[model samples]
Target: MKHADIKMAAEALFNERHNPLGAFSLGSETHRAVTIPDAVRRCRWIAVDINASAFGLFFVSPSPERARLVPCFDSDYPGVAVSTKFISGSNGEEMVHHTRDSTEPRWWTDDGSAAMNAMFGKLAWTGPMAPLAPGTSGIAFPVHADRGQCGLVVFTGSEIILKQDLLYEVHARCFSLFAAVARIRPSDAGRAHTISKRELECLKLTANGHTSEQIARTLKLSVHTANQYLTQSTQKLNAVNRNQAVAKALRLGLID
Candidate 1:
């Protein structure tokens, strides 16, 4: 799809008011979610510009991947940059079963089951359908051919391939916005805002739908301490609440 057309469609669909087709839109800016629950509901699987270290979010305007409805803050997040790789075990790289012609995202279906199980153990969820296919999945695209950082905006779920070029452009742009919003958040600082590993442990449990008291019991810590850890973690992430903290933490690679 032409870039101009993609932008217009994205703007229309991402409005807070439901469009005629009633597709879900999480506002024009992704960071507006500000809470883990909101973020998760919007995109079940998300990672921000992953690398060996560091993590961050943002939004792309017009395309629904970056800006609009973004809170007035001094932060500058990332853009929708992508680096899609071709899988081929022949190159001493991991390979997957996919059609070479398609630019859509791919996941490990029954095709890569053995290797996936060896790497991650058996996944418990049946995904969106029955009889689970286990393994890892992510979206990648070869945008930005030459200069600059690969504008990475990472989010994943059971995304079916939309063969239309315009739709693909829309999908990619929306993710770019998600990344930008994240990148702009304040980076972790020294001691005062550093999130503890234990706190992170608690945060993951909480993300798994656990209550504060349950997390405390599971960790064998006082309820007050459990709550305190959550509060501190939330503050460290600059999140409005524990849920946002969890979402931010997840995006930041602070938790699984």
Candidate 2:
């Protein structure tokens, strides 16, 4: 498929109005499920990983060799070293398997198995393994639908060779699409505002009437970084200045 066509398809896949829990169902219903082959045919990758935590959902294609996911736990493989937590939800667990060197094929080793169990919790449900052939690589993108539920679409194979910049762009677009879908609120619900941790810190200091320079010093960042955070918060809040940014942030419950 052409690059533009792939992008359009990806946007439509992610932007569907169904709840996050329905991604897997959509995959089954649509007849054109997103998978490793799809990713490689359209983009480039040997494998992929997608997951969601309370902080936010992310889909990372061409993830590190050892990366994996468990939908039931809403977690990733070898959970020990990672800093994120799983988002609580009811979707059954899913896992994506990939290889760095497909020609010299190797299945999941003991370490890999152990890591999967540890990250997903012993009792979590597991999904089927998607294999990659020789000379290929893969990428996984996580899609967060709603209610802390999520799903993954993995792309793999050696057919498409991708550059780092292109891969990053693809994943960035994927994340943006996922976020847009995830932000839709139910009519009767009181939606919670979200700001990245950095944005929250900046807003808190701004609310205290700290100058950008002062906030930067306190946060151990350059004034430019502090200003950038404020700017982002202002944009997120649709506000005009530091004071308005803080007020709007508070009103939106973006910061405690």
Candidate 3:
């Protein structure tokens, strides 16, 4: 699809009032949605997993399961632990929690990290999904706004082989729409304690290579107060220093 066409389609997908499950439920009663096949015909399977809690499944040409919602933390899937961390990274989050031995011997013994790197690389390149094997691929793209709740889109298929360009286009379009949605949604509801809006502003400026003095001047705060905010934010985010804190805040959506 042309860039303009992709942009239009993404806008439509983002505006469509669907459930948190994502594009997989396009035709369902919950929300007016867009069917994945209409956008990318070559896709054989589609699944969307969000926040490592909910997952929506879709298959265009059929597979083991036509469609389902599976829990992400289920231990039934051996390699899911490593894969989940990659997903967290893709969504710009730092650190993922997994139990000890969540890494299986059989799975880790067979070049698992290399495989994970390859898979995450493709996810970075192709969007958020990886092939179950050659010719069989899946894609999951996160959906969220700049200051809103987050979700995802997932697609998987085994019948049709997708082109590299088309895959890249799909990935980019999905992420763009996801970001738009994030802007419109409310801030995450479960946040226990958030950095004050002032603190976030300071961190965002700092992340853009601003000095504490610059940030303080920009925010109309004294240098000492600016430094205090930075130190407090860094501690809350568990960052080692100002630079690391800035990076972590951005990654955690604690700042712009």
Candidate 4:
């Protein structure tokens, strides 16, 4: 697809109005059903559209003193470590470095020297996908959010490639997905707002499709007390009922 076309599709996917093509949209149901997992599942199309064989999302903390990264999600590649070393590793350092240092999109390939010096072969994108060694060709898109939060969405394939224009546009889509997920999963500080441990447990059970009685049995609480906890949590979250409360709590990262 053209860069402009991809941009429009991304915007449509996150628009507030319900989109008829539910498969392509995250805002189709007023965002009530939106969750971090759901967002990741829906955005997998990025890799699919580009024919990438591997896809991964990493949340990055770019503090020079303690640069760290956490894998938020991945697909098409199992048992692969998308850890801090993966980002700072030789073949990857330049791509991720450009991202963290300048917040730019980068494409990379191992030059055979990476395996030798571990840092000598680090190079910038010079053209379309070149004949790359296995496990070395990929595009990294930097996503910067408020409060110094940032992430990298990486797409890799045996012979994957990207044009300069498409690189920027695809990065925009990555940013949109990241922003949507951040809104759904609030910061840890926000977790302290309300909802006691017991209340959260009840809500989590409710989210797992358990009945109040079942939750009571599992937690060894009276059905009345279990119901009360659910009610209090629902009220505190400003939700209309247990189900809505569970949804809100999930969005707020209060419950898994």
lDDT leader: 4
TM-score, one value per model: 0.32, 0.27, 0.32, 0.48
lDDT of 2 by residue, 1-256 (tens): 3323444454465445333223322333222334332323222111222222111122321212213332211123323212222211111123322211111111111223344324323221122233322222333444444343233433332332333333434443443334343344211112223446787788888888788899999999999999998888677666677788776555333443
- Sort by TM-score, best first: 4, 3, 1, 2
lDDT of 4 by residue, 1-256 (tens): 4333443654554353332223233343423335755655655766766666677776553323223444566663334444323553333444444445554455555534333222212433322332212445666666654444566787766445454444544565676666555555444324325567788888889999999899999999999999999989878777788888887665444555
Local accuracy of candidate 1 as per-residue lDDT tens digits, 77-98: 2222221111211210111111
After superposition, candidate 1 runs with Cα above 4 Å error: 1-183, 186-193
lDDT preference between candidates 2 and 4, better one: 4
Instruction: Show the lowest summed lDDT stretch of 10 residues, model 1.
Output: 83-92
TM-score of 4: 0.48
Clashing pairs in 4: none
Error (Å) of candidate 4 at residue 4 is: 18
Tens-digit lDDT string for candidate 3 (1-256): 3333444554465445343434422232212323432323212112221112222221111011111112122121323433333333332121011111111000011123344335434432232322222232333443332332334444433222334444444444444433433333223222303566677777789888889899888999999999999888777666789888776554444554
- The lDDT of model 2 is 0.39
* Model 3 stretches astray by more than 4 angstroms: 1-150, 156-193
Q: Tell how far residue 95 is off in model 1, in angstroms.
A: 17
